[model samples]
Target: MSSSDIEFSSSDYAVQLDLIGRVNGLTAAKNFFSSLRDQDKTVKTYGALLNCYVRVGLIDESLSLMKKMKEMGFLSSPLNYNNLMCLYTHRGQFEKVPDVLLEMKTNGVSPDKFSYKICINSYGARADYDIMEKVLQEMDSQRDIQMDWCTYSLAANYYIKAGLKEKALHYLKECEKKVGNDAEGYDHLISFYARLGNKDDLKRLWDLQKSKCRKQTNKNYIVMLGSLVKLGELEETEKLIDEWELSCKTYDFRVPNVLLIGYCQKDLVEKAEAKLQDIIKRRKIAIPNSWSIVATGYMNKNKMEKAFECFKEALAIQTQNRGWKPKAGLISSILSWLGENGEVEDAEAFVKLLRTKVPVNREMYHALLKAYIRNGKEVEGLLVSMKDDKIDENRDTMKILSLQDQNSEVTG
Candidate 1:
């Protein structure tokens, strides 16, 4: 069979090109699009190719494509200009965002609320509060544009980022008024309120959400619990957990994990352990994250034995071939501590376990070397393994080797 064996209409071909772009198959999408002659190309086809370039981070290609699009008289809509603004933002060229917005208006493509919102974000990102406010005011004054909760919430987020707490709170209140029983909108407010540390407002909004929605889903409960935990209101979180257990339709460990981690963060390791034990007693399988949190808690309190036990439990339950990586700092600390004070066999076993989660890095090799030298074990094979892994030995490795030399001399 040849490439000509396949038959596709222009619309079908264009649609497939767009689908390919959506899946990030940029090369295939561009090649397929380029094969079509000028007569077969539509504005949508051009837009799809442009989107493909954008999705693949081909900024220069996208810019050239935009020029071609304008020459073909298809760049008349705000959507095309919005794409440029988005590309600029993604590339950290924030200052160029408002320029694209201005060009859109100059070309007689009436700016939509999203266009204005992007400009607002651009200004806010640069910390130009005055221009951001001006853009917001102009957006509000536009008769055709009805400001939505998302836009207001976006503006509130920028205000918070700028440390303009008063202005941020004002916009948050406005965002709340525009919410109107939108679950996602309520969730956004809950998150922002958590950041602002306004427990009272968070509680009030939580109540409002419950009353407006027919019943809370796991998402709703999780968001609310997360807020309470951030506020360090563990008592309230516990009560809410009990309530959720009674009312929830499904059992999700995520909700309880939030509080358990919170307890550990506050140095209440015993409480975290009890919660973990309770979950296991109920025949629920705890995730590696749950055990990792307890391990972190023990480490915080300087209980190395308990911490190692918890870390072992975490590794035992770790899912293989999943895109999960433990905290590199925790891994380094535990391995270093163990190498300094643990048996060589134990260090080797833990490193083997860690390779199942993350790639073998210099830190792991360093820890293993320290263990081997401290226990008077041969390290020639370990040095060869490090070279094979392409991890260069640094000063720390030299120090470990020197320690081995001293130990051998003393024994001799």
Candidate 2:
């Protein structure tokens, strides 16, 4: 809607202020909040403005706002306390999180699930498992509070990180029981199972999620496929692809990209290339990243010709002006090989394309120079070209030019 058509109330403006600040529009949000301050504003407006400061990572401003909020009796809300706790957590001051929780309690503000979870995370991050458990136990003991699946899943995550597999498994089971058709929850559990190498558990949960969800989404397929791939079960992932093709309503290249990545990861570049060709033959679109992965695999195998072709395919598939640049090392490898072996005209054409994506580095110029020297073309002309590109002649460039001149004198 046009600005003139939209007249936001104080609360609407407050939410907008918070949103703007989140996107790094702090100056604009601050000005708008200041304008609202002179008019009628509620505690919610103050809270939103404080949230803006926090979202923009203005720590000093956030702390000042917190003090102002307390003096104005706006600290009675759990949201204000939680925001401070979040700020401390974001700043890596884990020790400060518990203090905020304690202050909240002393102020007669009951800790919500989020408050307790944040405190638990703080302790878990410090590997203070004893205190983390105590906080969780305390949360469970509260008559007004009911434990959530998120807390259990979070506990499981930390336990997994800490190498407490038994406790992690227990909490994971608890979390699974509370999944309740939440797709993200299922994805989290699947990823955790992949980390734990619990293949049986992963399969069971995948089936359970499929039965619970009304219609499996592309993301669900991708997550499961990725987990299977991580477990080195490429055969199973391919079978699932068949199932997904039958059920999916729309085509998203990312669904099969997981398999392409997996095959390349295993050094099976041929299989990955075969899959890519199959997709093309079937008239389905594949993403450039898939081709790049296979290219990387070929590079690792020292198959520069195949790698260069795959890399070229990746560049050709990109939409106009997509800002895609291949990794630097990959570009260097292909250019160096092309200079040594490719036709001089082909090397020049490819280097021309490469310049569009990367700056003219000394190494790339060296390649073009070597290409010209090897093909008995004008090495001096390439030197002039390098000068125009502002690339100074290095020792290697001098060596190449000197050797070419010596060969020319001997032939004359």
lDDT of each: 0.86, 0.85
The residue-by-residue lDDT of candidate 2 on 86-106, one tens digit each, is 888898989989998999999
After superposing candidate 1, which stretches have Cα over 4 Å from the reference?
A: 1-11, 19-28, 380-395
TM-score of candidate 2 to 2 decimals: 0.87
Clashes of 1: 0
List the pairs of residues colliding in candidate 1. none
Which residue pairs does candidate 2 place in steric collision?
A: none
Candidate 1 global TM-score:
0.90
lDDT of 1 by residue, 1-412 (tens): 1267776666666787889778758878878787887776988788878877777677788889999888989888888788888888888899999988888888788889879988998998999988988998999999999989998898899988878899999999999989998988899999899999999999999999988877788888889998998999999999999899888776777778888888997899989999888977875667788888888888889887788888888888887315445677677779879878988888899989888788889888888888898888999999999999999988878987899989889999
Which ten contiguous residues of candidate 2 have the minimum total lDDT?
316-325
Instruction: Report the Cα lDDT for candidate 2.
Output: 0.85
CA lDDT, candidate 1, residue 343 = 87
